[model samples]
Every structure is written in structure tokens, then in C-alpha cells.
Target: MHATPAPPALDLPAIQALAAADMAAVDALIRRRLASDVVLVNQVAEHLVAAGGKRLRPMLLLLAARALGHRGPDAHQLAAVVEFIHTATLLHDDVVDESDLRRGRKTANALFGNAASVLVGDFLYSRSFQLMVELDRLPVMRILADTTNAIAEGEVLQLLHVRNPDTDEPAYLKVIERKTAVLFAAATRLGALLAGAGEATQQRLHDYGLALGYAFQIADDVLDYSADEAALGKHLGDDLAEGKATLPLIHAMLHSDAATRDRLRAIVEAGEVEAMPEVLAAIEATGGLAYSRRRADDYADAAERALDGLDDNNAVAALRGLARYAVRRDR
Candidate 1:
């Protein structure tokens, strides 16, 4: 029998190590800002923040800032702001999705009550704005404002597509780009801005973040079906249960034969996965997983290319590695 080669190692740990100090600074700042006079606000916000996450978005900002030669308090401030915005979204998403679990733990809405979760999410949004104003840069405020607005718009768009069997691949891609990629783009662009990087460098980093965000979200969608709940940190088939016709499902539907397509359409329109075996089988028969993986790879390649001709350094190398890790990791 022929020998099989092992896959290359993931660079996430190395990237985390490289950015450790700054990430710690960001974490400390997040903790300080999360405090509230109201007990409920404090309890709800702190609960979610205490639940550990990879902090990837904030790390992206810190890394991009350092890569562009910025070492200052402002980057830490903005990184905290980014995290608050992200956490706020999670609180709201759980309430909207009626999700019970996240990160293999009960969701804020489940544990804290839906009203409390929604109110705390609003608190985070307002708190993020307060932090943004402290930065005293109008452009920074502008970018964050626009990015947050776009994310809200994306949420609405996603709601429109729920249980929508007709949702096409382009519509789905647009949702991911707006909901996820824009924030990543804002994070990197903020980094370049903080470093006083020129327009061209900022554009390159922005493109890198945008493409990376697409890759990351697509891979996440794929994992909804393929990953173990423990590894994925969320309920398996949560997307399907929510009637989200993500890339894999969309691709499978497109490639399936008439009978398979009808079965999928009925399942999707009803937003039930009682026939999960049939759905998985159809996806496999149609090569949906392979197609989604290939599409993710293409975006990862674009992200890597976006860094072309930038200054060569550990930060730059980490950014390159991050693009690959976004797609290759199981969780």
C-alpha cells in the first residue's frame, strides 16, 4: 500500500503566540470596559465575555496594526471595540435564532432570558459607540458605523432568505460578505489607519481581510454539517434547523437530480431536517462538500495574493498563514 502524507500544521497557534502580548492587552481592555452600574448589564455582558473565544477578529486588528509598525494604545482600544460589536451580534443572533447552545455552552438567551440578552446586546452596541468616540478620529468612527450598519442589513437579508428554497448562491455569498467580511475588512483597515499606512497599503490589507472573511464564514457554514458539536462549539445542523441554505446546501440543490431536488426543496422550505440522512446523502451524491471546499480555497488564495509585495515580516507571514488556517481548520 502507498503511504499517505500528513497535512501541514495549522499556523493559528503560532499567530496567537506572535500576537499574545497585544491580545492580552486587548482582553484586559475588554474586561475593564464591560463593567456596568446595572447588575443585569454587568451579569449578562460579563457572562458572554467570560466564555472564551478565539478572539480572531481582534487578533486580526492587532496583527495588522503591528505589521504596519503601529504600537500604541489606540489599536488596543479599537480591538476591544471590535470584540464588543462581535459579542453583541452573538447575543442578538441567539435570541433571533432561538439557539440554546454556543461554544458547547448554553447561549446567553437561553441562560439569561431572551429579553435580557437583547437588552444587553443593545448595551454592547451603545458601549462600542462610546469607545469609538473616545478614539477621536472621525474616519474611524465612519468606518465602524458603516460596518455595523451593513452587518444589520445583512442580518435582515439573511432573515429574508430563511426557509427560502429559492435563495441562490450569489444571494448567500452576499449575506456572508456583508454580515461577516465587512467587519474583518474594517478590522484590518483600522490597523492600517492606526499605523498611518498609505492608501495603497490600506487597500491591500482591506482586500486581504475581505477575502479572508469570506473564506472563514464559508468554512464555518460547511462545518455546520460536517463538524462534531464539541469541535464546532455549536449545535450540529443548526444552520439547517434555522433553514439557512448555506453554500453546501445550495450547491447540493443545484447539482441534484429532479427527485433529489424536490426532496431538498420540501425539507428546506419547511425548515426541518427530520430527513437529515436524505439531505446528507444528497449533498454527498452531488459533491456539495467538495464544491464548497474548492470555493473556500479559491477565496483563501485571493486573500494570500492580496498580501503580495507587502513588506516581508512575521506579521505579514502570520497574515498569510491566517488565510490558509481559516479554511483548513476543523474548528
Candidate 2:
């Protein structure tokens, strides 16, 4: 791989404006749905929400909606819905992965314990469905319900893949499509649907979101080995340490010598990366990071291609910029 110029940042102010508007609406919805005499519910919900996050889902929804000429308030409500789905997933993810750290901080499961986190996650999931009913849009409900199920299936598949170093790219891609791309597909597809766009336009947005998600998750996997721990806000090589068979390991195995391949395989199968430095070295020696980045690049390009039928707009331009950044980010 050759050195490439960095992708430009989105006018964060623009994204923030999008975030703030969405958050205001989302907050209102959250408050209304969460309003309860149960003190524990509000406390747990607040803890999870206040935990730092990029609000990427809502931002994507806003950008997609704007790209398709949404001038009304539907985007805000929908944006909140997107966030609720994402947050609930995180809550459940921490529980399932038994993760101690996220975004360089203790996860809700770590802080609140698995039971609270899982229950809160359940609350958020049910709350999102309640909000969907308020929208009175059965189609949106179907999309979200289907997306959530796919995500759940993805998580289970990933659980199955752990400690199995032979997990191939095809298997991994299926997990990504479910765990990551489904929500992305839902977010953008909802934007198109809410805007009353043509079916072709709706599908284009859906494909774009799916590809973008693939790029995003692949980049994140690459960063675990390539990025500084400080920059990542978590320990580097966590996935390898956890025995997850991400793209880097899969690609490395494809090209490594027998001894190197065994070493890599052993590390994951052992589920304790005491030899992480050696494993990272082996992966780097075999061009695994480069291979992963290239695959991520292909997904990013696919996302760009999906926009071929959409009318040009700032939101579309920003999304293109974001797709570029997704694969390019160092952390």
C-alpha cells in the first residue's frame, strides 16, 4: 500500500448542528418514554446516555435525511430512534463481550454490572419500539425490528467464531452485514422512506449505508493493531487478545509461512495474547494491515458507487467525505 493524503474532516459544526437538533428531539422522546416512577430506570438510562459517544448513528440519519430533501421534523425523531438502537446495542455488546473498556472508558456492564446493563439495554430496546409505535409507521417498525434481529444474530455468530481462528472472510462478512450494516441500512433507508423518495433512491441510500458500515467496522478492526492505544482510548490488540478472528488475522493467515500461521492461530486459540507483540509483528510482516485497509477501501468505494443515483447535495458530499474518513481514520 502507498501513503495517501488524509481525508478532510467534516465541518464538525455542521455535524454538531445536526447532532444537537437530533439530541434535543431525542432527549424529549427519551424523557417521555422513560418517564416512570421507577427511580432505577432513569438512573441507569442516564448513566448509559451520559457515557461518551460519537452519536454516529443519529448523525448518519441526519445526513441521509438532508441529502434527500427532508425539511420537516421527522429527521429528529428518527435520529433519536437511531441513537436508541445503537445505545441499546452497546449496552448488550458490553455484556456479551464481557468488555471492560469502551471508548477508553469503563463500559456500562463494567460499571453497573452485567444485570443492570442488560436490563437497561432491554429497556432502551423496548422504549425504541414504543417510540416507533408513536411514529405510527409500520414500515419503519418492520425495518428496525428486522435490523435489530440481524444485529442480534450477528452478535451470536461472532460469539460462535471466537477461539476459532479458521474463521474466514466470508464468515466474517456475514457477521458484519448483520452486526453493523443492518442498522446502517435501516438508518439511511428510513431517511429515504420518510422523505417519500423513489424506491430506487431508497435502495441506493440503503446500499450506501451498508457499505459505509462495512468500511467503518473493518477500519476499527485494523486500528486495533495499527493505532496507538492512547489514540484509540483503549488498549491496542484487544480483539486479538480476546480471540476474535477479525480481518487482519484472516488476511495474515492467507499469506504467512506455516510457522507464522501456526503462531497466529495459536495466539487466538489460546485466547490470551501474552505474545501480542510477536503476533502484531507477524501480522505486520505479512502485510495484514495493508490487506485489511484495501478491503475497507473496496467497501468505501462501494458506498460511493451507491450514491450514483442520488441528487447532489451537501449531505451527500459530507457522507462521501465521511466514507473516505471511515477507512482512513487512524483510531
Candidate 3:
């Protein structure tokens, strides 16, 4: 019986530095392909791109490719394709969520209206497919096409759960698996595919991405309850206002007394933003945040374990750091 060795210390800046060159290329490609003759399309697409998120998904692709010994222009094109697909989803997501802010800036839908945002999102999607066609790889095309379909299914699945207090952990996990984890899997798997890695290695990378996505989304749910609004880049109770029954709230409800459970249910069902104080109190009392954090830690550990057989290198090290950072990030 041997204990699993601990992962190395997480250094996010170091990880970013390692991927900095590749990411710059991806960014440039994204900007170049984002241009459209229609002024509104350009405005909406540029708005989201300029907001400047961590670009973690495409970075995952680049890092995975490097870990598998690939340094080619094809990775850059595919990385940009991943970004465009991700950005398109975000655009549509804001419209569906009716969100006003993202990354501390007004959402595209907020600035340009839902119609413009949706149409531009379509443009990005089509552009991504065009880039994929240029790559001339059927496998790449299949993976992304399937991933986008799964994301659409995830959106509808989440819509069904929204404002429904009956949503449980299993159902929530299903939503995240499709909405988030599948794309993460696609990104890393594509990395492996591009590098001509074996089936086993590709499977490992896919598993790593899947687990990381779970950890990241779970940690994000916890942050919605406990993180500073400024650092979180959104209102504290945005999930609650969206009537989303995320892990913390679900956990709190499961462990609370009938009265408290009913209160939580009402809050979720009614999108009761004002009930955040009470919800936080219940979560604290029930150790819901602690429970959710523990779940995130488990998934992060799985992500690290999935990388065990990969050759040790700067890229692999960064992947490990990313897994830890997924659960530990402030925003």
C-alpha cells in the first residue's frame, strides 16, 4: 500500500510563461479571423475577445501538443479554432443567461443586444468550421462537430434544470460533463491527435481534461457563494439570480433541516438574489462550501493522476499546475 505522491507546487505564472509564445500566436490568429465585413459582427466579436479571459481551453490544446512533442503551425490553427468555438459558445451563453457582465466588462449581448450577439456568435461558429476545413483533417472536424453538438445539448439540459430546485448533484454533473468537460476533452484529444500520439496517451490527455473541467466548474460554483465580487468578475449571487442550483446550494439543501431546505429551494426556484445572505449562512452552517471544495480537490487529484505516465517536461509541468490552479484560482 503506497501513498500517491503529491503534485508539485502550482506556479500559474510559470505555466503561462511556458505557453506564452504559442498563446500569442493563437491570439493573433483569433483576431485576424474575427474580422468581418459587417460592422456589427466585428464589434460584437471584438468586444468579447478584448475582454481577455485566461484562454485556458486553447492553452490546454497547445500544452498537450507540446507535451506530446509537437511544435507545428497546425497546432496554432487548431488552437485558434478552439478559441473561436469557445468564444461563440460564450456569446450564445450570455444571450441565454441574459448576463450583463463577463470578465468585469459588459457582455456582448449587453452592449450589442441579443440579436446581434447571437448572429455574430453564428459567424464565429461558421468561421471556426472554415478554419477546420482548411486544416483538411477529418478527425479534427469530427471531434469539434461532436463537441459543439454536445455543448448545445448541455445548454438545453441546463435550461431544463434552471429554476428547478429538484436538481441534484448527479444531474448537475451531467450538465457540466457535456457543457464543459466534453470541450476540454476535445481540446486535449485534438492535441494528442495532432502530435500523432498513441491511443493510450490520447485517452490519458482526454481524461486529464475531463477531470480538470469538473474541478474547475465545481470550484467556480463554490466561488459564486464565497468569492469577492470584484475578483469573481460577476455579482456574488449571479447563479442564484439565474435560478441555478449549483453544488454549494445543492449540498446545503441536502444536509439542512426541512425549514432550511425549503428556504433554499424557494431561493433557487424564485431566483431570489436577496436571499444570498441566508443561503450563505446555510452553506456555512452545513459545510456546503467545504464539501464542494473537497469534490473539486478529488477531481483535481484525478487530473494529476491521469498525467502520471506522460514524459516529464515543461509542458507537462504546466498541465499539472493548471489542474491545481483550476481548483485554487480566485476568479
Candidate 4:
């Protein structure tokens, strides 16, 4: 008897190819909706959209919608809305972090000035709300409203933890849930809602998005220390310079000797860029990076498991591929 054929490998290109047409539509919608009468707002918003990253969040919404057999224009509109919300967060985050660089280029706050960036971020947030209101779906409006509020709370929570070396893993996870995972969960859950999916299916997709968000952010924190500056598309040690005690640093502190722990804590409190070499050595010696990678992989696995009972389709396969990519990507 012939052996059972293996399932096809769904690499990044394959996944992107599968979602290309839908993404193109989403992009078009985004551009049209981003237009404003104010030129500065237009310039800043255009600059941000042009310096594009992977567009993963919107793609997640699109893929989830397609997975549930949704082919309507509502998916496109909602995807654009998700992109606007995410873009707004980035603008605000750069200002809050005092970051000069993102995606290997000057941040909007750096180029357009902080006030412009902040105001334009508000524009995007308000624009996104407008788009959602146009949808006239109460559930969609409610989910996004709650998600944005949680994100704001997360910013405050992270601000509190900044420069506090005592910030532990649980505290960090709470920040990640609000700042990153809530939006992700909103995207997928909205897709399911638009598709008229059952409540159980919606919850599973929400679980998938949340796990993927955790995996993505944890891996990003790892990359901030381990990846080359070009590959990472931002300054190495930015997190250190921001005084944010991410998982690696927390793990290193937990596992290291008293003297080393004290040194790490002191460096974090000071936001000392000059102490990076010492910090790297401590992280390596304590297996901090490895431990963090293991945690990211666990979350990725959880993301995949959340899709266990879903229909086997290209979109579902792409979702699985994204979970794998979330942990494996360099940037």
C-alpha cells in the first residue's frame, strides 16, 4: 500500500501567498480610509503606513475570517480597522518609550515631533472607531472599545514597572496580555463574529490569538537582546535602555548568584546602556535566553493546539504557520 501523503509545508511565503488577494483589498481600504483634510496628519499617517512591517495583526483578522468561510467586504473593512488601531498603538508606544528608531527607520515621534505623533495617533484611534461604527455591529464596537481601554491600562502598568527590577514574570505577563494580546484576541474574535461562527469557535480563535500574541511578544523581547541590529530592525538593548525588565532579564536575575543579581538589578534601575556587555554575559551564564525561548515555544504550541478542532483549510494552515513563525522569526 502507498504511504499516506504528507501535508504541505506552510512557510511564510506560502502563507502570504494564500492571503495575498485579501491583504491587497485590506490595503486598499486602509489607504482610502486614512485620508484626512489636514496635511500634517496625512503626512505622518502616510509615513507610518509606508514604513510597513509584516502587517501581521490585520492579516490575522483576515485569515481568521476566511477560515470561517467569510468572503464579505466586512472582513476587509475590519482588517483595516485593526491595522489603524495597531498603528495608533505604535505611535503612542514610540513616544512613551522615547524611542528614536523602529523598523530600522526614524520613528514618527522622532521625525514629526512628539506632539504631532501623539495627535496623529489620536486621529488613527478616532478613525478606527469611525470605521467600526460604520459596521453597525454592537459586538464589534464593544470588543474594540474594551481592547483599546485595556491597552491604555497596559501602558500605565508597564510605566509602573519601568525601572523596577523587582518586576517579575507574572507582572510582565499581565502587561503583555493587555498591551499586545488583547488586540490580537479582538482581531480574531471579531473575524469569528463577522463570520457568524458559534460561540465556542469564537472562543477558540480568541485563545489562539492570545497565545500567538504571547509567543510573538516574548520572542520579540528575546530578539531585542540576541538579534543583530539590522535583523531586529531596532536598537539592540532598547529594552534595557528603557529599564524594562523583560523575561530574559527576569530569568537571569532569578537564576544568577547574588552578586550577579545585584548587578543586573542595578543596571535595570539605571537604564544603563553601557552595562550591556555585562548584562549579556549574565544572561548567557544563567541560560536566560534559552529559558525565554522555551517559554515562547510553549505559547506557540498552545496557539496551535487552540486550532485543533477547526476545519482543515488553507487559512487554518496559515494560522498554524503563523504560530510557528511567531517563535522562529528573527525580527
Instruction: Write the residue-wise lDDT of candidate 1 on 1-331 in tens digits.
Output: 9754323323988888989999989988998999999999988877787688889999989888888889778999999999999999889999989999888788889888999999999999999999999999999999999999999999999999999988999999999998999999999999999999999999998999999999999999889879887888887888888999999999999989998899899999887867778888988988888899999999999988888877767888888889989998887
- Candidate 4 regions exceeding 4 Å error are 1-9
* lDDT tens per residue, model 3, 1-331: 9965544644899988989999999898889988888988887777777799999999999999999999778999999998888888899998999999888899998888999988988998999999999999998999999999999999999999999999999999999999898889899999999999999999999999999999999999999898988998988888899999999999988999999999888888899999889999999999999999999999999998999988778888889999999999899
Residue lDDT tens for model 4, 216-255 = 9999999999998997889999999999999999999999
Query: Measured by TM-score, how close is model 1 to the native structure?
Result: 0.96
Residue 221 of candidate 2: its Cα lDDT? 93
Best first by lDDT, ranked? 4, 3, 1, 2
Which residue ranges in model 1 land beyond 4 Å of their true spot?
A: 1-10
Best by lDDT: 4
Indicate the worst ten consecutive residues by lDDT in candidate 1. 2-11
How far out, in Å, is residue 283 in model 4?
A: 0.5
**Better candidate number, 1 or 3, judged by TM-score:** 3
- Per-model TM values vs. the true structure: 0.96, 0.92, 0.97, 0.97
Q: Candidate 2 residues 153-184, lDDT tens each?
A: 99999999998989999999999999998898
Positional deviation of residue 158's Cα in model 1 after best superposition, in angstroms: 0.2
